[model samples]
Target: MWLSPALLLLCLSGSLSLTGPSSVTGTLGGSLSVQCQYEEEYQSYKKYWCRGQNEGTCDNIVETQGEAKEKNGRVSIRDHADRLTFIVTMENLTADDAGSYWCRVRKTWYLGFWSSGTSVQVKVSVSPEKAMMFLSSSSSVHLLLLVFLKLPLFLTLVGAVLWVNRPLKGPGGSQPDKEKPSRSAPSPGKPCPGIQPFRPDRRDLQTLDSRAGGQQSLDSGGT
Candidate 1:
C-alpha cells in the first residue's frame, strides 16, 4: 500500500527525465539561478519549482502553466521550449532559503494517486553574510591574494631578525652586529697607500763625491 522513497522517486522519473546541478551556493542578499533540462516530449508540459525534501508534498513556489514566464515575489520561473529547458531565479537570498528544492513537471497521474512527473533534487546553500568588496574589485582581490601568499615569508624574515638581535650570554652580554663596516682604519706605522717616497737627484750625489776626493789629495801632499 505504501511506496518507499526510492521507489516513489523511480516512478516519478519514468514519465519524464530532468537533469540539473545537484547543489548550488549563493551569498546572503544575492541571487542564484538553476537551469533544468528535460526531453523535447515533456518540454510542452507544465513545469514548476518547489521547495521541500519530497517532490509530492513540496510547496510550489512558481510554475509556468499559464505563461512562458511566471514570477512569484522573490522567485521567478521561465520555460523555453526551443531550448528544452527551464530556469528558476531567486533574488535577495537569505539564510532561510538554504534548503532542498525541486524542479518538477506536471504530468499524468500515476495509479490515480501521484500527480507530479519527472523531478530533480537541488540543494541551495546561502552564506551568512554578504561577500567582501575585494571579491568585486580586481585590484583589491589581487592585493588581498598577494598578501596571503607572502605572509609566510614575511613572518620568517621577522623571526630571523629577532633571532639575530638576541642577547649574547658570555662576557659582554651584548648582541653582536650582524654586518661589519665596509671601511677599516689603517694600521700604525704603515704608509697610507697613495703617497710616493722622496729621493735625491743623480747630479747632487756626483758633486759630493768630487769634493771628498779633492780634500783627500790636499792632506796627502801636506804630509
Candidate 2:
C-alpha cells in the first residue's frame, strides 16, 4: 500500500526526525558537506534541506527521495537508499554563507507532505581577507571616536586662553597699568657734620643802616 506523502513526511521528519551534525567549519574555497538521518524508511516523499546562517531564513540547497528536486547554485542535496538520510554540500562559501540549515520533507503534490528540520552551519574560517577587513573597519571607527572626543577638549583649551588674556580693572574701575614699581628707591644728598645755618652772601650792615637813617631824617624834616 502506498503511504500518503504527508504520512511519510510525518513518520520520517516529525516522528523520527533527521539526525545530523548541527555545525561545521571550512575555508572560503574548501568543499563542505553536512549529514542528517531519519528513523523510518522513506516512502517516496520529496525530501529537501535548506541552509541559513546566523538566524537568517533558510535557503533551499538540495532535494531527493520521491517528488523532490529544488535548489540554488552553491548548494547540493543527496539522499541515501534509506530515503530519510541526506548529505548536503556547499562550495565557494564567503562570510555570508555562515548560518543554520534545516532538512525538510515535503509532498510533490500540493504542500501536503509533513516536514522535519535539521541544522546546517557553514563557517568560512579565519583568513587574511576577513582579518584585514576587521582591522581596517575597526580602525576607522576608533578614529571617528577620537575626533569627536577632541572637539570638547579643544573648546576647553580655547576658553582657558581667553580667560588668561582678559584685561583687569583698577580699584576705581579704570583700566589698570601693568607696569610694577622698582625695588630700589632714589638716594638722598650727603649729610653735613654738625654745621650751623650758613649764609654765603654777607654785606655791611652799618652802611645799609646809615642810608636808611638819612632817608628817615629827610622825611621827618619835610613833614
Candidate 3:
C-alpha cells in the first residue's frame, strides 16, 4: 500500500492522543459539557465541534471564526501556542443526545488540507428508577430466551450422545441363543446365516507336509 505525503506525516505525528475529559456521567433531560484539548505546537489553528447525529449527519456546534454565532456561548474554543481546547455544553439533553463528538484542527497544513479529529463517545443515562427498569427488562428478555431457546439445543445434544453409545443386539429383542449351535441348521457346504464361517486351523500345516513324504514316528516303550 502506498500512502500520500500527508498520511505519512500523519503517521509520523503518532496516534492522536485527543485531549478530552477522561470520563463523563450525565443524566437524561439534563445539561452536559464535553471538553477537548490539543497538544501539538501549531502556529495558527482553530477548533471545531460536531456531534454524530446519525450515520452521516454531523451537527456542527463550533467553528473557530463563526463559533459564537452557532452556539449561544454554551460553547467556547481556544487555540493558543500548543493547545487547542474547547468546551461544548448542551442544555436539556435528550435520548438522542448520545453520540460521538469530534474536535479537529482547521487550518492550512503543508499537505494543504485540514485534519479532522478523532472522536469521543458521549453517553447519557437516567437515574436509579429508569436505569433499573431498563436493566430489569433486559434481564427478563434474556431469561425468557434461555428458557425457550437454549434449552431445546441442550436437550437435543444430550439425547444424541445417549443414543450413539448403546450396544448393538441380536434381532427379535433377544440375545442369540448360547445353549445351542446356530450354524448347525444351515445345509452342508452353505455359509451360516447368523454366524461367520471359521477358517482352517494351523494343524493342517502338518497334513500338507506329510503329502510330500514326511514320516510319522511312534514312541518306543523302552529305549
Candidate 4:
C-alpha cells in the first residue's frame, strides 16, 4: 500500500517528533554537521539522511542501521542507539549543495512490511564567491558616501580661512599700493600747497577780551 503525502506527514509528526536545528550555514569548501533526536522506541530503526527535491521525493544520501557510522562521497551519517540520536555531516560544501535536507527513519512493522518512521527538515546554506564580492562592493559604496558627506564641509572651512586672510581694501574699494612715500611731499614745518592758515573772527576777539578782564579783577582782589 502506497502512503499519500498527507498521510506520510501525519505519521511522521505523530510517531516521532525529531528535534534539531532548523537551518545550517557554511562557507564555500567548508563543512557542517547536524543532529536529530528521536524517542527511545525508534532506536532500532534505520536512520537516513536525504536531500529534498521539488517533486515530493527525497534523494537518499547515507543510511545506518542500529548504532553505526556510514560515510559517502561528502556526506556522513552516524546513528547512536544508546542516546537515541543521529548525526549527519557534510564536507567540501559548495553552492550547488545548498538545499533542503531531511533526517528520516525507517522500520519494519506488520509482518514484513516496511513503514516510514519520521522525518525532520533541515535547510542548508552555502556562501559562494559572489557573497564576498557583494560585501566588497558594499564597503566601497559606504566609503564613497562618507567622502561625499564630508566634502562640502571641508570646502566651506577652506573658503572661510581664505576669506579671513584675504587682502584688505583701502577707502575707495581698491587695494592700496605698497610703494614708498614720495620725497616731494611737504614736511611738517612747511604747509601743504593748496591749504591756508586760520584767522580769528570778531566773536573770537570779544571772547579773548572778556577772559583778560576777569584775570585783571582776580589780580586786584589778590593785591
Give TM per candidate. Answer: 0.53, 0.39, 0.39, 0.51
Q: How does model 3 fare in lDDT?
A: 0.59
Best-to-worst lDDT order: 1, 4, 2, 3
Q: Write the per-residue lDDT of candidate 3 for residues 1-223, one digit (tens) a residue.
A: 9999999887555335455654455565467676776555432455567666441256766666533334644454544433355566666655655556655544454687644444444443433345676889999999999989999889999999989986656887776665774445667888877788877677887776776453333223233
TM-score quality measure for candidate 3: 0.39
Q: Each candidate: what lDDT?
A: 0.84, 0.62, 0.59, 0.83
Off by over 4 Å in 2: 1-16, 41-43, 53-57, 65-71, 107-223
Weakest lDDT window of 10 consecutive positions for candidate 3? 214-223
Better of 3 and 4 by TM-score: 4
Worst ten-residue run, lDDT, model 4? 11-20
Number of the candidate with higher TM-score, 2 or 4: 4
User: Candidate 2 or 3, higher lDDT?
Assistant: 2
lDDT of 1 by residue, 1-223 (tens): 9999999877776534888899999889999999999987686788989999897789999999644688999999999888888999999999999999999877766665856478888999998546654355767767887788777788989999999997765457765676767776778876676867666799988998999999999999999
Q: How many clashing residue pairs are found in candidate 3?
A: 0
In model 4, which regions exceed 4 Å deviation?
1-16, 54-56, 110-114, 129-223
Clashing pairs in model 4, backbone N/Cα/C closer than 3 A: none
